[model samples]
Every structure is written in structure tokens, then in C-alpha cells.
Target: MARTGALLRQAPLTVALAVVALVVGVVTGSLWSPLAGRPLRADLAFGLPSLEQGRWWTPATGAVLALEPVQYLPILVGLLALGGFAEVRLGTGRYATALVASHLVGVLGTAGLLALARGHGYGYADGLARQTDAGMSAGFLGAAAAATATLRPPWRGRVRVLLAAYPLVSLAHVGALFDVEHTLAVLFGLALGPVLLGRRPHLAWRQLTRRDYRLLASGLFVLAAVEGLVTAVAPGGGPLFATLSVQQKHEELANADTLLGASIQAVLWLWLARSLYKGRRVAWRWAVALVGLAMLAQVAGLVYLAVRHLPGWPAGLYELLGNGIGLAALVVGRRAFRNPSRRRARRTAGSLLSPAHEDQRAAATELLQHEGTVNRLAWMTTWPENRWFTDQRSTGYVAYRVHAGVALGLCDPVAAREADREQLLGAFADTAHAAGLVPCLFTVTAETARHALAHGWHALQVAEEAVIDLPRLEFTGKAWQDVRTALNQAAKLGITFRVGPLSEQPRGLQLQVKAISSEWVEDKGLPEMGFTLGGVDEALDPQVRVGLAVDADSTVHGLTSWMPICAPGGGAPVGWTLDVMRRLPGGFRYSMEFLIASACMAFRGEGATTVSLSGAPLARAAPPGGAAETGGSDVAQEPGPDRNALDAFLDRLGQTLEPYYGFRSLQAFKTKFQPRFEPLYLVFPDEAALPRIGLVLSRAYLPDAGVRDLVTLARSGH
Candidate 1:
């Protein structure tokens, strides 16, 4: 019942149409059997005869029939899965527009093709004109194709290639009249993809899915290979889609000119295409080699045909053209070959903490210790999974990664003076652009966002950092009543909050904290997130300080860690940013509040001016009854579905983690202390690059995550 409800809500138009079709099919003799025993087959199913006889409604009504019982289940599944998902992604009204528009074009198109074919006395066309075609698959395929625009790349592109190939593959094998209609229908669907996706992909598409450049090359590569199949099967050769002829037995090249050999090559194209889409270096190398060989063989065949006689001149020319196009495509898109595998990123991650990075780290440390950083999240600058980019002046550095053409800055730049920010940001952006990448700053504070905005970067509020002004701190207000009580109860339970570097902690105590952190991760049902977020290993960084809540038995109940916001001129730390916040399962409920309060007082005693509760990802940044971010934030400013895809994705992501992380709840807990709200923003060039930036940021944060880990994360809750 729930699943059915989901289907209706997702694709009301499709579900309604399918239900109507089933109802009509039950009454008409053409579908399954006639429930009403009516001789309605003549009026419903589409054919040239039916159209000529003026049964003009047949194109739409014809889809009501299952046509063949064996196909019914597949048609139903495709309609539900592809159509429903597209409708959900693209919205019901736009989905309907694509489906109806595609259907009308297909009906008129097939009619035109059949007429031309019949006039030419082609048996295939005459047979198709007389043959009845019925199904909603054409419309389904169209909607699915158009909806690819809503997906993130390289998936967006991969799905488009697969969908485009599906109907073409069917037409080649089946050679049925409706197969031709289905093939043409997909083109219309793809043509309307920009309208459905909200804008033209244009250069932006190439920029976003840099790894998918091979898809274009491989598509043409397969086209060149298909000519070989055509030459092997038919004597009159052209491109792959030329007229089908009787299979002929060829001389000399025994195995190479056989159907079995062509089939093997076709399967190899599939493997090569999949590999190329995944950015496998081996696949790119293989494609280049095979395309070279195929082009040479095609030239030889063309020369042989011309030398033997000009009998196959035109067809042979087309075959040569096809092979040339394939070779040219591979050469053009060669640089699009990015990663050998997902693991390639790990090998090239450039660990900030590694021996190989010592000189760079030492250099950066000296610079940062002198310049200091304003953004508390700047401490993530030292995370092992980062690549540093410094300007020529060496006054500041941006820790970043180039993933899928997106140069994602982990946080704000660490600079000696805030005044140097705009110049540094411009340099960073210019550097990224010079390298052919889109520059974006992720999980950065408002201070950095404003700076980037001054340099023409757009900002979107992502989360808010909770800052406790330690010099003016007090727990006497009504808002801090709950926090005070939690502290008192924690003292009664013998849960004392202890703070220090984990590396210098007692060995026995370190082991307990490790166990607690491990358990917390396993329970989250997802791979531990990195980049700005800290894990057990990150908590042990020599400079980071950890606070643990333990009882008399030294059993750890909860822990919090802080990363320093180095003081200006590299004098000393002026503030600390909360990093690792974890509590063991079944531990004291109030342990977190207790630990946070204790850390605040301890940091204050150490002469720290501020203690920052780091911003929560994808969580609201504003106080209750206010906008998310202070400067020009309106939550309802862009409420339409057209402008909400990124927000929708962010909302879903937040919900998925909310069950375990309770970031919103954590924010609420912070508000009880009357802390100042510091907004964070995702700074990028503009909306066109948001999706690509999103992908780059997700990968940077969760490098070790896989499909199963994400699935598990979605299913688990605290």
C-alpha cells in the first residue's frame, strides 16, 4: 500500500494513464482478452491501414494494449521505475509535457517513415505499415531521457548514454516498426532535456562531467566498430544503421567476418564504454589502440573495395568516414581520461601529516603560525586528506582538491591578515580556472563568504557556527538553566569532564576513548566523514585537544575535541573550534552538555577569547524565528521546484543524517547557552556549478564511502 502510494504521488499522470490503459485493454479485444467481449481491436491499435481508415485516435489509444503478454511485466516495471522517478525529479507537469510531446512526434514520425518506405517498395517498411504497434514504452523512454538533466554527473551523462543506446540496440536486433518509432522518440526526449533540466547544458555540461568526455569518444568509437559488424553481415556496407540485408559468408578472414566475431566485438564495446565512463586509464588506452586499429582496417577495406571495383564506392566511403570520426573523437577527448579508479584519489590525496608532506607542512605551519586564520573551521587545513595551494607571495594558502573539474577549497584560506583575503581568493580562483577547474569554497564562515563575494563569488548559506564568547561567558541566565542542571547531575554521577591532547593522555584512558569513538562510527551505519569533520585518528592530532567525560572507574561516557584558531601574528591560540563531538551508546544523556560547558570554562581559564561550536553541515544557521544566515537570508526566497533541487538534495541529506547526528538538535542545545550564531556559506561562481561542487565536496568529505555505506546510513538512526 505504501509503495503504491509512493508511485501515485511520484508519477500521478503516469499511474493514472497506466490504470486507464489497463481498464481500456480489459474491455477491448486487442489487450489480453475482451472482458466486455467487444470487437474493438480494429479501432484501437495503430497501423498505416488504421490511420488511412481514419481511426485517428489510435496513436494514443494503441498504447492501452499489452500487445504481447511476455512484454507486459517489463513495460509495467519500466513505466513505474523510469517514469515515476523522472516525474518525481522533473515534477509531474513537466514529465507529462515530455511524454505527450514525445508521443505526438513519434506517431507522426512513424507515419512519415512508413509512407516513404512503402513508396520506395521496401519490404521492411511495407510489413511495418501493415503491422500493429502498441505500448507506452516510447513515452516512458522519452520522459526518462529528459529527466537525466536533473541528475548529478557523471551519472547524469552515463544514464543519458545508456537510455539513448537502449532503443537503438532494440531497433538493431528487433528491426520492428515500433522499434524505429522508439528510437526516434528518444531523440525528442533528449532534445527536450534542457527544458526539463531547467537550462541548456552547453559548456557547463562538459565542465561538470569532465570524466565523462570518454562517453562521447566511446559513442563514436562504438559507431566505428558497428561498421565492421555491418560489413561482416551485409555485402552492401555503410554505417551501422544502413539497410539490413541477407547475411553473407565472406572469404579469407574466416573468424573476423562472422556474426560471432561481430557479437564479441559488440560486447567488447559495452565493456569499453563502461570502463571509459568510469575514467579507467586502461580503458582510454585500449580505446585509443582499438580505434587506431579499426581505422587502419577500415582504410584497407576502402582501398580494397576501390581497387577491386567502384561497386561499393559510396558505402565504402561511409565506412571510412565512420572510422575517421571515431579516431578523431578518441583523440579529441583524450584529456577527459581522469581517474584510473576511485582509489586513485587516495594515492594522490597528499596527506598533510605524512613524511612526504613534511617540508610543505613545516612551511605552511610557519606561515600559518605567523598569519593566523579567522575562520575557526580553518583548522581542517591540516587534515591529512588535502592538497595545498599557496600564492606567489606565500602570505596565505588554500587547502583544496580538484575532483571532476571542481576545485573545492576545504574551508576558508589561512592568511596572516584578513585584508589579504580578496587578493588571495582571486588568485586561488584564477589558478583553478587556469587549470580548467571550477573554484568553490566549502563549509566556510560568513567572514570568508563576504570576502569571496567581494571577489564576485556567490554565496549560499549552509550552516551556522555557534560561538561562545568566553571573556563574557556566564551560566546564570534562564537559557543556561538546563545546561547548569546537566553539569550538576553529571557531577553527582561522578562524570568529570577531562581535557588534554589524546596523544599525551594515559594509555588506559586513550583505549577507552578509542573504543567509544569506534562504536559511535559503527552505529552511524555510514563510513566516517572526513575533511572538516574529525574522526578517531584526527582527534589524536598532536595540536588538537580532546575532552572526555568519565566516571570514577575511568569509563568514558562522552568526548569532545577542539582545533585551535591560531592567534594573529602567530603569537598564541586566541580561540578553539569544537571538532569531534561524540557520546557512547547508552551513556549519560546529559554528558554532552556537561562536557561542552566544562570545555568553555577550561578554555576561558587558558585565556582564550572565544570557543566555537563548529557549524553543522546542511543545517539551518539562524536563531529561531529568524533567517538561516544574518546577511540577506530568506528561507522562502526561492520556493519553486525549479530553484529547489539543490536545496531539496541538501534537505534530504540533512534528514538522512539527522536521525543519528541530530545536528539541528545540537544547534538547539547550543542556543541554550545564548551563544552568538556565526553563519557559514558554500561559496561558488554561480548556480551552474553547484551540482558539480556538491559532488566534489561530498567526495572530499567521504572519500572512503561506498554505495552500501550510503544505503546503510540512510537506513540507520540513533
Candidate 2:
């Protein structure tokens, strides 16, 4: 049963069709001989002959003019075997199409060749010659060609060459010259077979080698030698020197030699096919069926031929046996070369989890906490709903998503020893890797920077931290020049400055609130800055501090606010802080500076040693290297009226506010500061896990609607 299944699987179509053709041919051959002997008394032809003459109707043609059944039975069998193998490999549709087209081309070409020969007055037209033949040789060749076309890159060229060579060898039969009719038909069939149906049926070289090529080669070689010797020792002459003068005999010998070469070619093809299909597995049924059917068809053809006195029966049978052996070899070879690792990898890739799955969040969280620190930047302190965490404070790491993969990240570190930093970074990377993630680190620390370079982390963008040093923080030099000029311009307009708490007195309250309200409207735009006294009362808590600036006329000029830097115990505020500041027309520069200075003095009186003047309100300029710094300094010396105006404004604002706010105009206004820029390091568990984190964060806090504006405001210090 298994063997039967295998044979069916291997050559289902070929086996079935071959059996039908053989049965039809035998029956036809049995009945047609008697009719052929009687000859035609009148001019009446039908079937194949009618078709050849372009006539649609002719009943006699069917029985009398179909292929000389007995003579072409072996050819039909060979074709069926070849076509079946080709069909199994190439797929039924493609194989059938190629075979049908090739056969049509071959039949038409043979007809054309016959016409041409007759036109040239070349050979006698016997009764047998008038009949059209039926065989699958052309179709099989077409399938073979199609199969060759399907080979992969490495074997394509060799397969092409083999296909091309088949025709050349077939044409080498000189006996074709004497038997022009049959010769023309065969030659035409060979020529047109591949032309009309160019694609070779798809066959794995491995299977071909195992099932057919190797054994076919051996069989063909033996048959060729036997045929050559028989021709050499024919009855016309001496045992070994027979028929030396006959051109037909010489052609036969040449054909035998060509067949010998074809056998070698078959052997090579088998080897290559075997090599290519070495690691491929085949279904057991398919393997058995294909081999069995081919062998069966060939055997059946041989038996029928032997009964009919047809030549080449033994050779054909041997060829069939060879095909079976080749198939067996392929089956064994495939089993021997399979690779388990590659199969596993394919399975793994196929099963990768989708990003949107909830499991991904769990995976990301587990990956981050595997290490002590989750290194990533805090673009938004609050995380969004769709992300792994609802806030940045959550225990998971944030990762930067890039084209290659996720890059693990951490917010700039507040403080850490060099060793600690290294440990954290390494742990971050290890965690990410454990979770099958990629790692990326963003940093502004020299130590972290060096470590990143050493470890092959890519440097994307370098941003400097522009800061004001509260201890030595004073706006002076070129920085204050712009402020001083603005102050002087305001003084000319009769603008004056004062400083006090929000609830100081009626005048102070009115001026401070007005200034705050006006500045808020101007900066944030009226629609965005909607508020009234009631709204302010609702929003501001007792913990908030307010400062006001007023003109000599008691009109509000500017105002600002701060929240105290609370102690660790959360008792009284430890430091007076300047959080948000704004200014209006009258004494704008002076009042703004005064408010800051007053807040600082208040904080200092309360025993605070240092002030945290916040970062620059804009994206800081790129840092200048050695020679570039010198060039910048040179440019600063050639200041014009604009510089003078800036200087005047800073002078007035700085002097009045310096004592209270500790504000040095030169230090505050200058682009260059002497204070050290502290490093902030963003750490991540690893590089690969960054994408999911980034996607989650980006979606929630920085939704498509508010992302641009938020970024702008943050950069502008609003």
C-alpha cells in the first residue's frame, strides 16, 4: 500500500496518461495493420490526414492515420516518464501547459518539414509515411526545459547549457539523411518542443538526481555501447568492420557516441541535482509514487514493444530502472543533510510577538527592572495611557526607537560616581539584551560619553546644558549690555522700577496683578492666557510666592512668581525660587530684574546658600572649540549702537537689583559663563527595548495635537 501510494504521489498524471495511451495504441495497432495492407482504392482520407490537409471532417483518418501505435510505444513511454517527473515538480498547470504547447509546436514543425522535403523532391512517400504520429517526446522535452528555468541562482547557468545541448545531440543522427521523412519529423519535434513551451517543469535537482538522472545515465551509456557494437557488426559485412562504406552506418555510430556523451551529461546533472536537493525532505507518498509510476510506465512500454518486435525495448527498460535508483538516492541524501538550527530560527522569526500586544508591556517592564536603573530621557514627566507606564516615574525604562531597533535610555543622572555610572549603564544594556531588546544611551556626561564610545554606542546629537551659577551668578559683560540698553530706553520714557510681595499694599497689588496679567496675555496670547482674579485665586496655592514690579506712577510694569524649594522634611520652604517671570512696557527691564533680585534676597535671608537660576529659555547655541572661541571673542569687540543700547539697559537693571537678587548683569547677559555644566545621563536597560517605550511615550503625553507646541514652549522657557 505504501509503495502504491508513493508511485501515485510521484507520477499521478504521468502514470495515468501513459497507461491510457498505451492501451489505446495497442488496440489501434492490433486492428490497423489489416486495413493498411488493403491500401486505398480511392482518394479518401480522414482523421490525422484530414487535419494535415486542413480538412475538418474525415472518419478514416482517426483509425488509420493516428501514430503508428506499435512503432512509437517506447517513445510514448519515455515521454510519459519524463513528463510525469516534470509535472510533479513544476506543478500540474505549468507542466501541462508547457507540454501541450511544445507538442503542438513539434507536430506543426514536423508537418512543415515534411512539406518542405516533398517540395524539394527528396524521399519516397510510403503509406506509413502518410500517417501522423502520436508521442509525448516533444511535450516531455518542453517540461524538461521548463524545469531547468526554475532552478535557483547557482544552478541556472548549468541547467541552461544542458537543455541547449540536448537538441544538438539529437540532430547528430546521420541516418536522418536517408530516412528524411522520419528524420524531419524528429528534428522538427525537437526544435519546436522547447521553442513553443520554453519553461522547464520545476524539479528539485536533488529529486531528479536521486530518482532519474544517475540511473538513466548508466543505462543510456550501456545501451549506447551495445547499439554502437551492433551497428558495427551488422550483417552487411565483417564482424567488426561491417557497413564501413554506408553513411547511414557511420551516422548511427556517431549517434551512439552522442548518446554516450548524453549519458555523461545525465550523470553530471544527477550529481548537481543531488547536491542541490541534499537537505530537502520529500513526502513519503510523493517519493514512492513518482518513482514507482515512472518505472511502471517504462516497464509497460517495454513489454508491449517486446511483443511487437520493436527495437530498443531492453535499453528502455534499463533506463526506467536507472530512474528508480536515482530517486532512491535523493530520498536518502535529503535525510542526511537537514539542518535543525535553521529550521528553529525560521520558526522563531515566524512567531515574533506584535508590538501592540499587552504582553509587550509586561516584557518591557520586566526587561527594565532586571537592572537597577532604567536609562532613558524624560521628554514628558507624565507617561501616556497606551504606554507601558502611566508616568516617567514608573519603574520601567524609556527607550529611543530607531530604524535598526530600540535604544535603551535613562534621564540624565542627578549624581553618581564613575563606577556607579558604568555599572548602571552595563546593567541597563544587559537587561535589554535579556529581553531581546536593542540598547541606546543618551548622555551629557564626559564619563558616560567616553563609556558609550568605548562600547560602540552611536553618538546621535550632542546638546550642551546652558546654565546660570547662582553663587557667582550675575548678569554682566556683553550679556548684560542688551539689558542695560533696554533699561536706559525705558528711563528716557519716564519708566521707573520697584519691588515688593503680592499683598504689600493697594498700589503694589494692583500693579503686580496688572503686570502679571498683561505679560501672560502677551506671551501666551490672549486666548491661551484666559484668567481673572477669581481664576488666579483658584489656581494659586498658599505655597506659591509672587513678586511685582511697578513704575513711578504706580502702574504695573512687570511681575514674576516662584515656589519655595521645600526641605526634604516638607516643612517650610528652604529656598526662594524664580519659577516664571514676565514684564510689561514701563520700566520693563528694571522691574523684571528687581523682582528676581528681591526673590533671591528673600531666599538668602532665609539661609539658602545657592539659587537654581534655571536653564536657558531656548535651545542653547552649539559649543565653540578653541580657535572658534577666539574668533567669537574677536567679533564681540566690534559692537555698535545695538550693543550700547543693551549696555545701558543692563547698567540700570543690574545696579538696582544686584544687591538684593545678587544679579550681575554681565554674568546673566553673557553667552559665556564660567560655571561648570553639570552632566545629565539618560540610561536604559539595553538598546533593543527602546522603540516600544518611545512609541508609548510619544503617543500619550505628546499626542499629535500638542507635540509641536509643547516642544516650542519648553525650548522657549515659557
Candidate 3:
């Protein structure tokens, strides 16, 4: 019931029109000669035929031409009902155009099909050979098809029901109850309707399959079947009108016995219309009047045809005027019924775009600027380094630089170290990991490494430090051969080697630093160590020495800074630490080795006995004794063989990673100096605290956490 009501509401006008058509059809038969065919001669042109013989048109032509105009009256009513309702829903002009176009196309298609059929070897060719006519049944079916296309959701099923009914009607005709051509014309109209009408509004499939729709469709199907069967079985001829000359016995049966059936159809159509109108809140008076007017026009047209037997002009003109008037009324009603609130909405939208809103631009701009700043700051720790901060002209107060692609504080390293260097480093590492940037620390001092362990920094062995007896060892023999070979290559390439202070370096020399203590230990994946570079100033301190390797063009190729090692009992100044080293472009041959040799010589000149080339900054090793604490004969305990094994493995890794990271290559290159390997121990605040460091490191480096940071930390000498 709800579904039927909804459908009726959606297409009230169509329902009303269908009812009017039925009423007109039944009334026409009652008022005019029951046996007579179509009222208008033009209808013959549309496949209808006159009863008169020798009319220039052939017998088949006359038969095919003949349309049971009564049958189409209901269809036209359906079209009008659907059209008006659709117009109400989709605007008057669109609805009107869709209906008219569909009808026109449907009619033309039917005519073309008839022509084609006649041209082909169908039996109709012999009968309709001389006839070339057209009719509006095709147009009516087309309108119905159009309605089907435009109807939405709950109403769609109703449209589908009507569409299905069209073919069934055609089948009834083919079953010998009615003319097959007429049925074909109606179906052709219906099939073309959707094409002309275009698409209906979109709705969910479930909405279209309601209970009332099923009930109504079932009832209609049963009714149509009963009508078909009655017409099929009923005999022809009636005593009330012996003078009548019916074309078929079925026509006589329809005229004599189907009055009650026709009346019932008319009543159902009216009920559908009334239900639709009521649901839509359309004024009952207007609906009633409109229906009455349509009925009157249909009656007037029928009466004129019955009395005058007028030519084509009267019937055509009457139909044209009547349809035009009906369309006008529909248009007026639609305009009057439009929602005022929708108009107000358009006005409001227009107001927003007006010049009065121009002042809001400033506020919008401020909001955008704030958002951009917040987003930038939020993502600041994400990269290895802040590329944006490198630009001196950058406006924001926040600035950063990548120390080997790891983001670190520029001015707050001390604060970070105090608060928790490990946490800060972890944040930086996490940010870098997320951004796919490599997180690394270069030239980090022992103190910083300790701080990293305290906060949680993992280490892996990359290379051994090559401490040389500066005063005793000479750069000669097999060692000299290697140095000479490197020098000769450098000489041919016009490369030079030079040493310089931090202030006297060429523009090609690049400098970077890692704080010994800062809130950056979390990324290192090792417990923190208490170490601080807060008191050390590399540029001004006399205890520190900076070494440079440059090419012939005076371009710095590599550099290493050295500082005195702190020891007890009046420090002996036994070795100079390689605080920093870098390879400059176009540097001297054996630049790295040369830099170490030169630094060793300078330290010897300074009365130093030995040089601490420095442990590989990145190195790690597994615990000794085959993953267990007990020392066994099976495990070679040659001063922690497990540590040596891990170092050896990292040495291989350094060889592999050398080409990619220059620092890794430097670590490997330093091996030729034959410095003693040392084990670097990470002293965490507590052993149980390692997992926290590991978690932060995992989030920061994921799969590479253990391999890069932990391995490097574990292999480094304490």
C-alpha cells in the first residue's frame, strides 16, 4: 500500500491522464457506432483503416491501418498522467519536452517498422503494399517509456509494470484477439520512450522494490490476463445493434460483454490518480477540474467525429488544441507550486559571492599561514636534515641541518642533552625513518658516544683505528710503495696535499659536527653515556689540531681534527685523536692515508709519542662465548674473539658500504694504518632499559635499526 501510494504520488498527473483516457475510450464507444473503426481518416495514415471498401488502400493496408482507438485512449491517459507528474517533479519545460519528443520518436519508429515489414517478405507485404500511414499509439507508448526512464525509486517499479504490460498486450494481439500490427506499434512506442526521455533520477534498488508495488503489479497482471482470456473465448455479434459490421468476432465481444471490464479498468485508473494526487498535496479541486476538462475535450472530439464524419483536419486540430491546453495548465500549476525556500537558497549563495565578502580574504590568508607553520613544525623532525633551513633567507624562526641526514638541534643541543639526549635523538631518528632519510652521526666523540649509550645508542664496528708511533715509524718500503703509487697518480692528475687550520680552509672544504651529548640517543638505539662537548670549542682551543688534505688546485680533499687525549698523572700527550675527517673534491693521492701520515707527523713535531687515529665511529659486536655468558674452549677467547668476529664482519660491511657513504669508505681506508682494534662498550643506565632504546630505534629505523645503529654501536671500542 505504501509503495503504491508512493508511486501514485510520484506520477499523479500520468495516473490521472491514464484514467481520463480510459473514461474517454469507454464513453466514445457508448456514444458512437460500436462496430465502427477509428473516428479520423488520418488515423488510417497511422495504421488505422476505414470500413469502406475500394478505398485505394489494399485489404492488408486497411487491416494494418485499423487501430482499436479505444485501446490507445488508456495509453494516452497513462502518458498524460506520467508526463504531468514528471513535469511536476522535473520542472514543467523538461517534462513536457521529454514526453513530446518520446512520443514523436515512437510514432516515427512504428511507421518505419511497418514500412520495413511491408518491404520484407512478411505476409503483411501482400496486404499493406499500397498503404503508407502512421498513428499516435507509437507516440503514446514512447511517452510511457519516457516516463519509465524519469520515474525514481518506488515509482520505478510501476513504470516497469507498465512497460511489461505493453508486450503482454502485444502478445494478446498475436494470440488472435487483436491486430498484431497495432500491438507492435504500441510496443515500439514504449521501447523508444526511455531513449527520448533520458535517465531518471538515481535511487537505491531496494527503494524500488516495495510491497505495494508488487501487489499492484500482480493485480494488474491478473486483470490483463482475464481480459485477454474473455476476449479470446467470447463469441461475436450482439442483439442490441444488428446493423453493426464488426471486423472481428473479438471486437463484437469487446463491445457487448466487456463493458463491466472496461468500467473496472477506468475505476482503477481513477483510484490510482486520486491516490497520487492526494499524496502530493495537489489541490483536489484543480485535479478534478483538469481531469474533467480532458474528459470533456475527448467527448467533444468523439461527438464531432460521430456526427460530422469530418475529414482529418477537425480530429487533428481538436487533438492538437486539447493537448496544448492540457500542457499549458500543467506548466502553470508547476510554476505556482514551486518551493519558495529553494529560491531563497540561491539568493543566499549569490550573496556570499558578492563584493561585501572581500574583507574575509585577510582572515583566510592569516589562517592559511598559521596552518602552514604548524604543519611545517609538526614535520620538522621527520627528515635527516631540514633542507628548508639551509636557505638563509627562510623566514620561519625554526632552522635545522642534516648531520648525515639526521635532524638535530642547532642551538639547543645542551638543553636536549640535559633533558634526555636519547629521547631527542630518537625523535629525530623516528622522523628520519618515516621520511626515508638515512639517520647517521659523523665525527662523534667518545663522550657523545657515551652519552648516546646512556640514552640508548646502538653501535656497530666499521673499522679499526690505526694509532702510529709518530716519532719512530718512517713512511717507506711496502708502505712507501703504496704511498708512492698513490702520490704518482696524484702528481699525474696535478693534485696536491696540504694541511690547514679551521679558519684557513678553502671554500670546497665541508664541515659538520655531532654533539658528544644531546637528546639524540634514542635514534642510536643504545643506553646513554655521560659525556658532554659543552666545554670544548674546536675552533679556538689550542689543545685541538685540525688537519686538511687538499688537491693541486688548493681544494680541500679531506680533513681531520685532532685533540689531546686526557689521561692521569700529568698527561703524557701520547696520541692525537682524529676529531674529524672529510675528503674534498680533487684531493691529493692517498688523501686519507696522507692526511693520517701528515697528522701523525704534526703530532710528532708537537712532542707527542703516538697518534690515536681514532676507533671506527660506527661499529658493533655480539657478546662473547657463542651467545652465552660462559667462556668455553670451543669459543676462541683471544681478548674477546666474539668482538673481533663482529668487527671483522663490520669490516666487510664497510667495504660494501664504502662506495655509498664516504665515511664508511674512510673507516675501511684507515685499516691500512694497522691500528689496534678496540671494543667499545655501551654502558646503559641499566641492562633492563635496553628494550626501551630498542623500541625507539625500531620505530626510527625499522628493519635497518639493528644493522645500522646497533651494529655500529656494538662494534665500536669503548
lDDT of 3: 0.40
Provide TM-scores for the models: 0.71, 0.30, 0.27
> Candidate 2 clash total?
78
Taken over the whole model, the C-alpha lDDT of each candidate is 0.71, 0.42, 0.40
- TM-score of model 3 vs. true structure: 0.27
Top lDDT prediction, candidate number: 1
Q: What is the C-alpha lDDT profile of model 3 across 308-402, one tens digit per residue?
A: 75433332353345445444443334322221232242354322111223333333222223322211011212222222221112222122333
- Which one wins on TM-score? 1
- CA RMSD (A), model 1: 6.7
In terms of lDDT, model 2 sits at 0.42
lDDT of 1 by residue, 1-718 (tens): 9858875877788788778766765665435653222346567767677788898998887776766656667777888888887788788889989888877677668887787778565555666777667777888888888888876544576677778776665565346666777787788888887876668645342243343355576566565456456545653322232342333123423656677887788889877876775556777788878867866886787687668653444444655675677667667767666445535543544322112365666666667767887777777877766667777664788877667877788777888677676667878876565344678888776677777766656676778888778988888866678889989999898888889999998998899888888888788766777777888788898888999999998888899999888865677889889988888789888888898899999999999998888887778846765412233432223233433556666766777778767777877666766777866777876455667766776677678999987776656622
What candidate 2 gets wrong by more than 4 Å, as runs, is 1-410, 414-422, 428-444, 460-462, 470-581, 584-618, 622-718
Candidate 3, which segments miss by more than 4 Å at Cα? Answer: 1-464, 487-500, 504-543, 551-553, 570-572, 620-664, 695-718
Please report, as a residue range, the 10-residue window in candidate 2 with the lowest summed lDDT: 627-636
Q: Write the per-residue lDDT of candidate 2 for residues 586-688, one digit (tens) a residue.
A: 4465665455555555566666644433332112233343211211111112122212332333233334333323324323432333333333333333222
